[model samples]
Target: MQINGAQMVIEALIAEGVDTVFGYPGGAIMNVYDEIYKQKDFKHILTRHEQAAVHAAEGYAKVSGKVGVAMITSGPGFTNAVTGLADAYMDSIPLVVISGQVPMSLIGTDAFQEIDAVGISRSCTKHNYLVTKAQDLPRVLKEAFHIAATGRPGPVHVDIPKDVTAEIAEFDYSIVLDLETYKPHVKGNPRQIKKVMEAIANAKRPLFYLGGGIINANAAYEVRDLVQKTGIPAVETFMARGVLSCDDQLLIGMLGMHGSYASNMAMSETDLVIGLGVRFDDRVTGKLSEFAKNASVIHVDIDPASISKLVNADYPIVGDVKNVVNEMLELIAGIESQKYKVWRETVQNFAKLHPLTYHEDTERLKPQWVIQRVGELLGDSANISTDVGQHQMWTGQFYPFTRPRQFISSGGLGTMGFGFPAAIGVKAATPEKISINFTGDGSILMNVQELMTAVGNKLPVINIILNNNYLGMVRQWQTLFYDKRHSETDLSVQPDFVKLAEAFGGIGYRVKTKEEFDSALKDAVEKNVVAFIEVIVHRMENVMPMVPAGGSLFNMMLLEKKGEK
Candidate 1:
């Protein structure tokens, strides 16, 4: 059958089992938008901006464990979505972004809304394509989805010219992709798996340092299986927050610069480090020379290049994390679990010494308390999202994630204005569960326009603004290292968030006390509507357990402010 490229795009998406698409319409992509309007097989979320569209796609992918699809127009529209591309690329989120381009005849003419998207996005995207021919659209679109969801997943950009979308072509969704060099290995070598099993058995103090790849590769079940069978203490990186449930006996808290005292201490003293899909990020590895000095690492990751790139692996197994960990489980049935009993007790003592704490005062509302209250109020019923800053760290510290993909945020890029749109997407993907975003006053305003999107779409995502009125993280650094010469971090003069939320046709609240916060939270969750709570917290609160840059994780300040408790 003959069909236009726009119709083929929709048909291919439906064939790929895509149920949702986040996008914005424009002149260059009007043909595709017209087809989207005519189709009823899937849903399209009209986000407020191009950036928010891609972010919503990310949120959808994170929770659904499926490839996210998004669409946008050319020129500035394409440029606007760059942040989301880079964020997904850094974090290995699978995304297929279809961006419209000027007609083929206008190439290199600097035509209206024309730019080299392939050039601009080459570095950030895992792969990209410029589709000028209608006959190739079927294979290119299929390939984009394949590449985006395959090994070391990242965003794949497909630039379709406006003229191509309007042209007629024979449609075929069953066309076999011809690329043979794109295979991704999924199974582990038996010998390497045996070596890892031996290391786990012979070690005295072994720890499992997990990363986002565990979640991306869908290896949570295998990892949890391995951890439970071996009785090894586990510490999750920020992106791998909920691999082990908070109540899991062997689970250590998140380990990084702002990790728990118990986790950092355990990492410093471990003898065998079983690294599962972790890149050993600088945040997790404070000082390279001092990080895990006493340990020999057995690293398992699908990306071969990531192995021994930063930290040399004593036993490197380059295969899918799930497959490798599953193979270990087969061999792990013969091992005993009593070796790390003393090490576990020592780590627990470290936690008892200085737990994740804030000055629990009755007068002022601390950011930690606000985040904790949210966790207490909406356990299991809601998933958490956050924009970057002190609030992001506070949520990471206070909120206990019990399942994978329950906590979504920009881990690598640390992008502000990510949470609100992400929550919108999460809500869109799963309307049965409430979506909550914990954002800072500084971060929320970056994409505040998304409030309209949420309200218009009837996707009720609660926004908890930790209203500190200053860029809290940077201010803490200035106070600690710069002799308190506060620079341009103060954000005291901003619009009333409550009024802003109300202006966007959503519910709003301003809470100054804990009692008020508790009341506001109860009302918001019960109302089940798009709401924003402007929590008037202490203006200068800091994230503790600070491992100063270039310093050892073993040494950290456990205070709200330096030299002051």
Candidate 2:
């Protein structure tokens, strides 16, 4: 079949099973947008900013476990996506970002809407390509999708020149992708699996540290089964919150900078740490020299570069998380479960002693209480997205998500203003399930215009704003480390969030108490409309269980008495 390059791109995407795309239109990309307008097979979300488009695609990918696709124009439009590209790069998300560029002939003449997008995105992407001819369009696109969705998946950039998109080409949608430089390892070595099994069986106090890779690889059940069969306690990273149910007996709480005290203690005392599908970021391994000093680490990751990069492991296996975990489970099929009653009891005692507590007053609303109630109302089936702030910390602490991909947030990048648009994407991808965005007043205001996108698409997403009247996370840092100097952290001029939602043709409610929260949530869920519920909280409230920056995990600041820091 023969078609224009623009039509070929859309057709190829359809064949690739991309049901939804988030994008913005401009001069250089008008041909692609025009092609998209003629098709109703796939959904396109119009975002106010290019960055929102990328983040929304990220949200969709995280929830659907598919390669997220986002399209944009040239120059500033392409540059606007850099932040999101970097975010996905650091988090290892599978994304295909298509950006328009100047025609091939005018490459270096400073043409209108011209920018070196490939060069700009090279460092931030897993791989990138610039299509110089129409004949290469289909192959380049196929390669881009393959690279983006392969092992250790991350963002990939395809810079399509305007001339290339307009050129007529012979499009064969069934061509096999044959890129030699892009092969991904999908299976674990049998010897490596046996080595890990032996280590697990020999260790008395073994712990499994799970991360987002489990969800990405759809191996949550396999991971859970291995832990149960081996009788090893597992702790999840923040992004891997829902890998194991909070009530699972073998599961400990999250581990990292703001993780539970018991989890940190367990990591400290473990004899073997099996890191499954997680990168050992600095936050997870505080003071790297002393992190898991007594443990023999077995690191399993799809990306070869991540192995032995930060924290050296005794054994490293490079393969898909699902395949690797399954192989290990098969190898250790008959291994008897070890009794670690003393070890489990010791951790349980620490958890009870240093339980996560928040002050509850009838006069004022607490963020933790609101998160707990929201989790209770939505149950475990709902998808939740969060912005970076105190609310993010509280949600991680309170929400009990047992299913994978139920919780989405910017963990590694810690990008603010990610919640609302992300919620819209999640709702778009999973229309049958209810999605909510937990945001702070400061973070919501960063991309509040996205409320229009939600209403325009009729995405019934609930937006919960934690109105603390300040930049909560920054203020907490200032209070704790900067000698109580307020600096410019206070956000006194707050927007009327309820009115803002109304302007966008969405429902809005202001909640200040438990009864108000119940009413607002009930109305939001019952009504088929985009809803915003602003929960007003104290300005001085902060997320507790904080380990000071650059400090050891043992030295934690427990916020008990006000003004006692």
Instruction: Name the best candidate (by TM-score).
Output: 1
Positional deviation of residue 177's Cα in model 1 after best superposition, in angstroms: 1.8
Candidate 2: lDDT of 195? 83
Q: How does candidate 2 fare on TM-score?
A: 0.97
Specify the poorest-scoring 10-residue window by lDDT in model 1: 556-565
Per-residue lDDT of candidate 1, residues 1-565 (tens digit): 7999999999999999999999999989999999999989999989989999999999999988899999999998999999999989988999999999999999899999999999999999999999989999999999999999988899999999999999999999898888888888777778988988988898999999999999998888788888988888998898898888878888889888899888999999999999998999999999999999999999998888899999999999988998888788889865788877888898889888888788865667999998888778787778888999889988888897888888899999999999999988888887888899999888998899999899998999999998878988888899889999779988999997788989999999999998899999889888988999998888777798889988999999787533465
Clashes of each: 0, 0
CA shift at 164, candidate 1, in angstroms? Answer: 0.9
Which portions of model 2 miss their true places by more than 4 Å? Answer: 561-565
TM-scores of all candidate predictions against the true structure: 0.98, 0.97
What is the per-residue lDDT of model 2 for residues 351-379, given as tens digits with 9 covering 90 to 100? 88887678786688988889898888887
